[model samples]
Target: MDIEIIAIGGYEEAGRNMTAVRCGRDIVIFDMGLRLDQTTLNEDADIVGMQVADLVKIKAIPDDSVLKANDGTVKAIVCSHGHIDHIGAIPMLAQRYNAPIIATPYTTELIRQQMAGDTKAGDAAKLMALKAGQRYTLSQNLILEFVRTQHSIIDAVTPVLHTPEGAIVYALDFKLDRTPVIGEPPDVARLRQIGKEGVLALIVECTNVGKKGRCPSERIARDLVRDTITTYEDDKNAIIVSTFSSHVSRIKTIAECAHEIGRKPVLLGRSMEKYATIAEQMKLVSFPETTSAFGNRRTIDRTLRRIMKGGKDQFLPIVTGHQGEPGSVLTRIATGDTPYQLMQGDKVIFSANIIPTPLNFGQRHLIEARMQLVGARVFEDLHVSGHAYREDHYEFIQFLQPEHVIPAHGGMTMTAEYILFAGEMGYTPHATAHLMKNGQRVKIR
Candidate 1:
């Protein structure tokens, strides 16, 4: 059987993910996602309806034309995780293909939420809740396995699509966290078995493969939070923290710290409320009873009044805008777009790294410059990545030993560095590495 992979939007950059795998005439879709920055401007319909492109140049919402070209050959659609960069394009793409999407339970919830929240209703989705070890048959030719993985969000998995020829493992955006609180460890046993079974091709995420060492654990991140917050966190002032809203584990850690320090935690912003509700319903995370969630302007106004009057130290607010998105809750609070006024000497903790994009770089710096002017103390980089570093990736290659390898999730420089890790192993230059860009296709036998 001949296999062809189209490197869709996310291949060239960090977001707007789309990928296609063709075997003979049968095709399997890996993910369909959107660029967060681009999607921020798009309304609900713009987000979930149509094959959105050409108008939103910054976004590439999967290569739907390629999927259609399969002519009903799509056997299944598998989303690796819940990050918008991985599943954001699903509602748009799933409408065109009548395929059952396979993902873990938490990821399933996210997909459903995204669909339900979208004006399109994402009703086109046909979802299958997959556990880490469950095996499902996509077609006679493709038997698929879901191998659990660790990431910022829970229920991340590396999919192993088993074909008659061999297995192709799609390992994207995973960190090998032995101590992940939400799920079992990475299915290392299955990975070892796949290694023994002989993997045909392994598509690995190159998001952080350029970094040489293994990523620090979430526990380290907790310690960083402890150090940053205790040292700079104003127990005497209202504390504001910002982070990736989808990151439930990180949120749990911060919540724990807030409780330990006797700050009443308040979750702000839309995403913060959404994921936390899902996580609580799923029992993946739980916050202390003292924590409160606020969304509406009027509610937040009342809460801030109580906080301002009672004492700045009375409540700790967790809001979005880690990348300095202009109108996000934290940004509005910082700039006074919202009713909440910041007292001088108040502290803002950024439990995130400024995603290194030109747009994000400028926006975040501008926000920080403004914060500095307002005399707000800011603590940043007190976070850990959810992706494996180069050394961790080396271990992944050593484990899978696939006949072909493709770096699927980074720019040219990062992608090349990702593929080079495989080259360092025994595989030849041509036999091993394929660093593909968006719109490019790689054929495998």
Candidate 2:
């Protein structure tokens, strides 16, 4: 059997991550995602109703038209997690393929919600739930297994395709944290066992390869949040935190800390409510009893009014817009567009790093200026990264000593850095380790 790895979108940039693995006539598609920076350019962009061709033209979603020339039938569309950059394009792209969308139970629910309004995608694709440590047989020649893994979001896994040639491991977005806040640590024992079994090709993420040392564990982040929030336990000032809404573990930590400080946790904004509500409904996570969430704009405004009326110091608002996106809860509050007023000595804690885009940097600067103008004290970077650093990637390579290495989920600089790191392990560039771009392919066998 001939095996080839195709880089669809994420290789050239950090988002819109889609990759296809073709084994003879059978092809398995992985992660139909979106580019947030591109998609968010127009604040009022109607993405749900936008055509795939239009999104492709604007470089928002993966241009899967490259697949038409590749001779193979798509067997399955596998999603790694529920992050918008990982599963965001499902509504626009999954309908084109006659295959079931396979993801963890939480991710499946998110996908179902994502495809709810799109008649074409909703009617065309079937959603399937596969838990971590479970195996699904795609065909006689292909066996799909979801190896347990830890990431920012809960229920993350590294999908492995067991083929006749060897096991093709897809480790796009994951970490090797021994002590995760929400789930078990990455299944190191199983990954080592797979390494012994023979891995043909390993497609891995290179987002943080340029950074040295292992990435800090989420436990450390939990402690940081606890230390920061507990300091103001007796203070009379309002405290608000902005972070990634999909990061349930982080949100749980924030909510618990708020409860510990004797303040009610109020989750604001649409994404915050959606991710947390789904996780709670699935019994994956539970927030404090004093926690409440409001999603719709009207409800969110009403909740903000209630918070203001009750007293700002009585509640800790965990909201969206850590990147200072336009119209986000934090942005609205900073710009005085929301009912929630920012008074002097009010605390605004950003629990997320800027996503490293020119637009994000400018927007974050603008929001910080606005908050400062209101005399709100700003605390930044009270969080850790979800991507694996250099040492983590080294340890990962040690776990899966595959024949070929394909660095993904980043641009040329990131992938090039990974190639250099792989060289330190005796892997030659393009010979053992490969650097790829959008719409490119490499044959391992």
In angstroms, how far off is 420's CA in candidate 2? 0.9
lDDT of each: 0.78, 0.90
Q: Candidate 1, which segments miss by more than 4 Å at Cα?
A: 38-58, 68-72, 121-125, 230-234
State in Å the error of residue 270, model 1.
Answer: 0.3
Residue 396 of model 1: what lDDT? 85
Best by lDDT: 2
Candidate 2 lDDT by residue in tens digits, 1-445: 9999989989988889999999999999999988889777422123677778888998889989889745689999999988877888899998888899999999999889878856657563489999999999998799999999999999999999999999999997998899999989999999999999999999999999999999999999999988889986469889999999999999999999999888999999888998899999999999999999988789989999998999998999999889999988899899989899998999999999998889999999999999999799999999999999999999998998999999999889999999999999899998989999899989998
Q: Residue 30, candidate 1: how far off, in angstroms?
A: 0.6
Clashing pairs in 2: none
* Candidate 1, position 375, lDDT: 85
